[model samples]
Target: MQHSLISLSILAALASSAVFAQEQKEDEANDKYTDRIRILGSSDKLRTLGGAASLIGELELESFEFDDINRVLSTVPGVNIREEDGYGLRPNIGLRGSTPERSKKITLMEDGVLIGPSPYSAPAAYYFPMISKMTAVEVFKGPAAIKYGPNTVSGAINLVTREIPEDFDMGIDLAYGSDNYTKAHAFHGETAGKWGYLVEGLLTQADGFKTIDNSDADTGFDKTDLMAKLKYDLSSTNTDQFIELKVSKTAETSNETYLGLSDDDFNQNPYRRYAASQVGLMDWDHDTIQLTHFIDFQSVDVTTRVYRHKFSRSWQKVKGFGNNAPSIQTVLLDPDASGNQDYYLRLSGQEDGKIVVGNNDRRYVSQGIQSDFGFKFNTAHIEHIIDAGIRVHQDEILRDHFEQDFNMLAGTMQNPQNKIFTTVDQEKSTTLALYIQDTIKLDNLTLTTGVRREYIKTHYQNRSDNANAKDDWLDKEFSIILPSVSAFYAMNNDWGLFAGVHQGFVPSSPKQNDVDVDAEKSVNYELGLRFAMQNTSGEFVTFFNDYSNLKESCSFSNASASQCPIDTDFNGGNVDVYGLEANLKHNFALTTDLELPIVFTYSYTHSAFKESFNSDFPQWGNITAGDEVPYMPNHQLSVLASIVHGQWQLNLLAKYTGEMQEAAGSGVELSDKVIEAHTTFDLSANYSLSAQHSLYAKIDNLTDEDHLVSRRPDGARPTKPRQGVIGYKFRF
Candidate 1:
């Protein structure tokens, strides 16, 4: 029975080489389409996983109907998120004690494949998938993380999409909300003969919640996503085999900016955008195609996946005033400090001045092929299951940046200068990953050991008009071997304990000079307990990461142009991070027809540098032996409660995120100009009008709580204000 529990999601894909590939239904084992990368979405699999993992299923995902990944992740322990844009667009996410900047320190995937724009060259998720169309989300951590690859320092996240149905089915969801927001989502799936197919589409648009100075321009965004999947079973081959093809496209246009309000301006109106930022905007398009082949033999299983992704993005936003060299932080922190008065006045549209804007245009290509093999054997009284995989991935990033000078006349642009090339560059990486994991089970104990080998060759070419970058376009290569071990012991049918240790690594960006920076390396450890009693079940885990050499990658999304130059690596020396994660859930029977379901999650994280150092990297500047890491919260908590009676359900959620620092400093960093602690609540009510129709109403930030969310990459930013929405759903 234990061997039959197939691992899908991260468990199979474990790190870079898939181990369990999928979870197969005993009855549907012959139809590879029936297998799912569940990511241990069920409690039973998680209890014996020998690691820490969480699954957000359809029931919970549709409860709040959250279109934002940040809000949804709050309910998972050990996750840290930094909110921006009020919406979850371009989310800053972290697991355990990893940096939450741009979510580059972890592995991100969709349906068991890497999904970041350029996971190997430019990992920043400037274009994340639409969460509204996802059927489930899986979070993986601990030693198991080593099985997932590239950035095992933190963890991994996999977004699972809807699968082709076995029977005819279709559904549609429509909603209207505040700020002129609108959403439409529809999906259809059916099986015919030996073929199964699914088609889905989603559209979301909004007028934005921010007001522009002397302008009525919308600050919101519009996004569209379409996907189609086709699968065919090859029963005619006289063996259990199937092939599936998936194709998807996404396009978006958002009027967003990196510029935030000054401290004084934010205090007065946190939602106001300065006239200088009127040019802020971004447009992007992404397309992906994937093909998968599955074969089930008498003694082994095989899964082969081939995927390719192409993405293009163009963003135009205010760079600065005049020379565009002065740091925005300097002027915003003290607008009346004589030297900053002119910049401040001009920013607020109170004075006519020349402003500079820049356009960041980039294209990305990511393609890879991976194969997995799994088999079972027995030796004496012990049983063993072995999973081995190989993957070859190549990704590239092409960058072209331009800047122009503009004259601001009375809060409106007057004359504009011709665009000039600022930077032109390209980065590429070719990676070969091989991994194998063995799961040994004897009685009530399950033990797993795995090793992953990585070989990466990278190249960077800079063709900037400026001399800041080298033109050599040199290539560099690096290789490493990582090992992991974990075990789970069942104390009884209701209690289990797990522990693991693994070697973690994160590769340097292809643009790195190699001589100055070594790839990030660390040893990670975790221990936990799983318990279930009646309708109550919970997990408690503690993790620690000891870094021998930490590295920081700078990006415009989290750091200033002057703080840390883009496409560069900064050495962080030695460091240590430790944390605890706890999650509990229970259901109470109120009556024969009513029930109450509750879930609670909490996270505590702490980090410290081993040696004192000074650097331009904003988050790690002037680090001391005992100084805490910036942007890392000490406490995070989330609670979800819901009542179900007949065909009616009501849900409430509360989240609390502790204050964070813009830069590493004392524990009271918030005392300065850092983000302050904040709490928010959300409510949702849903009623099923027969089995074919349903209605729902929801409100975000129900308490109208106002708080500062960040202070870097510009000036000051705030959380979203209160908003509400109503929707209807139809399914047959």
Candidate 2:
């Protein structure tokens, strides 16, 4: 029934939807006329940045047909990812050495708008846009990332959607693969007179690869996405203006569990699912509506957006045999222990017992209005671009969490007990933010200066409180001011230098604030050298983030939570994270009609706690001053190569993620807490049937590499096995 949200949006739109760069019309340029919805409007905007940025252009994305955000972002430098589900239903992305848990440390956006459920109140990315539907991806780091506050410590990513075509245009794609994976994508867009519109829909489903004990349930997931956009153009001689409205809906249902296997059990079969997890399931729906107005007056322009998004979700997963029992991880790690073997026996259905499952029902609302004013002027023959912006945003989260007890008979839940309301958490945040940035250009030197100020107000109610009295609620207020400066110098056509320094901040959750948890703050610095040569381009950069107070959040999703309260913060005092990134790209011409392009990216990160502290946090147990940060791999590398010939293209990509520690420590890594290193390769081929039709095939995990990706929440989790798919696409 949750799928009805998108269906309703379609009816309301009966209303309104660049699959790729080469597919767009050359004469119709959205950038030249109106204000852009994208952060980096074009490749030309990248040049030599005051900071570092990456634009995964349409040419590359369209060629790869990557449905997973993790796969897409792995090609970029300075990005670290931890794979959870074989598919990227939930992505853990970290910029530099920031935390990669649920991507809460980084800012996520679509078309320049915050896309998280409730960015300011609850930043966990339970709802992420489909990657296959995006046209381009823009990533910003360092000082330049401050513009997208409340989360400036890690950085920001913008997912660009397709725009309406100049004329009538439409496309359809269909594919089927291993494990009963299927995909259907279609879109249509057109322009008439001064009005234009676009409508699009996507559906992907699969029969999960894992087999559950004594259960026939489909362990996979099904997802649906729908969108509508309407636009009215009001343009004249010296001015350009337009009003656009966008509506979108996303829904999903997946049978996933946090239960993992013991090391001995994992060694026998990595993909096995315990019988106790047969009841695990999750359902979620999200809806959004946004209106934007843009107008240009010669050298000055103004653009504003008003948006509201709503998200609701419910996840029912196994808790344990008893409420006070040890965490699942504890038992899975040492099943031979006297107290742990019984839990393990019940999990495997070897003995009948009562089971407890928790259902976290959550609702989120995020609404905001933001505007930007741009000015272009010249002073003393020097060109300058000035931008100022202001935003007033409010977001809230309401969680109605409860648990139920069930009698398990042969791995299936029977006689369920009455549901118990375990907790009710309500939190909200309102923020007023203002920022101004100036870009000065003279000769071959460019300098950028920017400052941002934030005024935040928050309210929270203590968990498990049933009273409505004002005394049961807590309110708090705070302010933060951040400043940044960066410079770029072009020594010649082949070489350039860039450097930047900025203040970074990530606010604690509203409830966390009510508990007097301190927000995270840091001073970040970066320096880089860029070069261009014959048929090749490359860059080398180094970055350092010195945090006066670093904060880590603990939840059942990424860490063992028995030692600490749920959804609480742990202060990691005085920490420094330093890293180096390198990237190189080159194009080789095998013949006049055949061309090969290759790209490589590498990153090395080192983190240390400058002050020793004692803590019971599961992920940071017994921290020493020089102990390394957990879940941070010291080395990462990615390589992408494509062979293009007449009417055909073949692509191969391989990535290596170094070993990581589950808990913080230094010296020779302990054997038990280490997540071993692994490398995987993917291959794809595309053949053009005509200008309007194409055929493509791809094989993921070409070598069927089975390796532990993480040991979090539960036990060992493995990557996807080898899977292949063939598909056809049509466009006009």
Candidate 3:
């Protein structure tokens, strides 16, 4: 049904393209142009601080038609992406040495608004923004990320959506690939005298590559997104102002599962799923509305934004094989253990079995108002640029979960029981934040100093018939102040030295007050050099993080082996992390009409515990002073090259990720459950047939090397194999 709907939409778009082209002929002849007014802090110029930051522009985004966030973010340094589903539907991104589980350690935003579900309470990024519809992506790393907010220990990622076009414009893109993959994206916009409006829609679907070992069910997903924006110019003689309103909605249905195969099963066929996961499914819906007002004056600029977001999801998946049964992880790790084989056999429907499935239904809402002021002044010989911001926000997550038992017979599940073991958990938080920063500029030197204060009040409640229910209701309040300073000295037009130091902070979980776990805090330092010439530019930074306290949260997906505790916090004591990140880009103009661009990026990270303590957390087992942080690779590298001539463009990318430990251990030996290093190559090409039409093709994982990517919540999972897609794009 989804495929048919998308096909119809594509056909309509294609038919409309012809009519639009004919109608736009007169407008094209007029050649009218209007300059777009950029919102405050929306341009790439905002990244000109003495720290590491990257801006992925529209050209780069259009090069590969990459819908997956992981693939697009691979070009950045000091970033790590752990693949869960091959399509990156849910990304686990880590910056520096932070944990990647649900990307909880970082600040995620879209159009400068918090995108995470209940960012102040439950920051799990179950509903990530659709990357295919984004116009650009901004990454702020190291001390430079202090401006973004509450979870600044790692970094921040901001997805910039398409702006209201200045002039009339329309575009459509359609693509199909292997495994029944299909995508359709279309947008139309126009700016009149005082108002601009845009409407866009995207649909993507795929029949996944993995197969259920003994079932005929399909592993696939279908998703759709729609957005509309309106902008009104309210400028007058005394004030230059504009008000913008945006509304968006997204829906998804995926046949996904958390149940993976054992080592033997993986060795036999890496793309096979267990029969128990045949009924696994995830359905979700998300909606957002935002209103922003911007005013620009001679010496000052002010912007205010108010936004509200709502998300709901229901995930029905197998929780365990049976009551009192070995966990899926145990069965995958040691299938031959005493009762593990029996449990596995039952789950596979080779024998009479009872499977426990959980209905994880949850709803989240986040709403906030934020205001920013920017001003500049000159005093004596120093010029000062001051920026200040304040935000008042509230977010909450409400979960109503229950379990059902199903009987499996003859490779089929039947006789589902009534819902049992109901649980109602609610987490809510209110946050107030204020920040101010000053940039002092002299002849060849620039210095930036900033401070931020965050006050949070969290409340958690659990209504369940379980033994721990009595201790489930709690309220906590906390406040913290973070400070940062950075300096840049320009030796010449082509060279500069930069250094920074900042405080890193991560908030505590709302439901973990009883654990007395403190908010994660660290002192971060970085030094780097920037060099640029006519056609070459490069940046290198060395960073260190000294943690006073490190925390591990036991969420639904990440828990100890013995117990799947939810909302529990574990203290990992102090930790030290250091890393080096470097990026280089060179453009070679081989001929007047031809040019080649080459880029290289590298990162090396070493993270270790500073104090030893025993813990029941699976990832933090028996913590030793020198135990390496789990899942953090020591080295990562990537190289990309592109050649363009006239209307033809070709690109190639090579990426390598070094070995990483799957568990906290003190050795680098292969026996330490190390995830081996892997490398992948991709190629893309595009040809412009006319001003209104273009053709493109992309091949990912060209080498088709099967490699283990992760061994976490379940068993080992492999990355996507070779795949190719061809598409057509039209613009009017």
Q: Of the candidates shown, which would achieve the greatest lDDT relative to the real structure? A: 1
**TM-scores for all predictions:** 0.94, 0.94, 0.92
Clashes of 2: 2
Model 2 regions more than 4 Å off: 1-29, 32-36, 463-472, 513-516, 665-672
- Each prediction's RMSD over C-alphas, in Å, is 7.0, 8.6, 9.4
For candidate 2, the 10 contiguous residues with the lowest summed lDDT are 17-26
The digit string of per-residue lDDT tens for model 1 on 585-609 reads 9999999999999999999999888
**Stretches of candidate 3 above 4 Å error?**
1-48, 465-471, 560-562, 666-671
What is the per-residue lDDT of model 2 for residues 1-732, given as tens digits with 9 covering 90 to 100?
667998988766654312233223222335633334676677666666787788898778877787889999978888888788888898888899888888889989989889999888878888899998888999888887777787888689999888877699999999999999999999999999889999999999888878888888888999999999999988665567788999999999999888878888888998898888888898999999999888777577778899999999999888766667877888888889999988888887777888788888999999999998888899899999888889899999998988888877877777778788876878899999998889999899999999999899998886675565345676889899999999999999888999999998988776675354678899999999888788888888899999988888777777653556666777887899999998899999889999999999999999999987776567776777988887789999999999999999999999999988878843211224788889999999999999999999999899999888887768777888888988999999
Assess the local accuracy of residue 544 in candidate 2 as a C-alpha lDDT between 0 and 100: 97
Mark the 10 consecutive residues where model 3 has the least summed lDDT. Answer: 29-38
| Residue 605 lDDT (model 1) | 94
Q: List the residue pairs that clash in candidate 2.
A: 17-198, 17-199
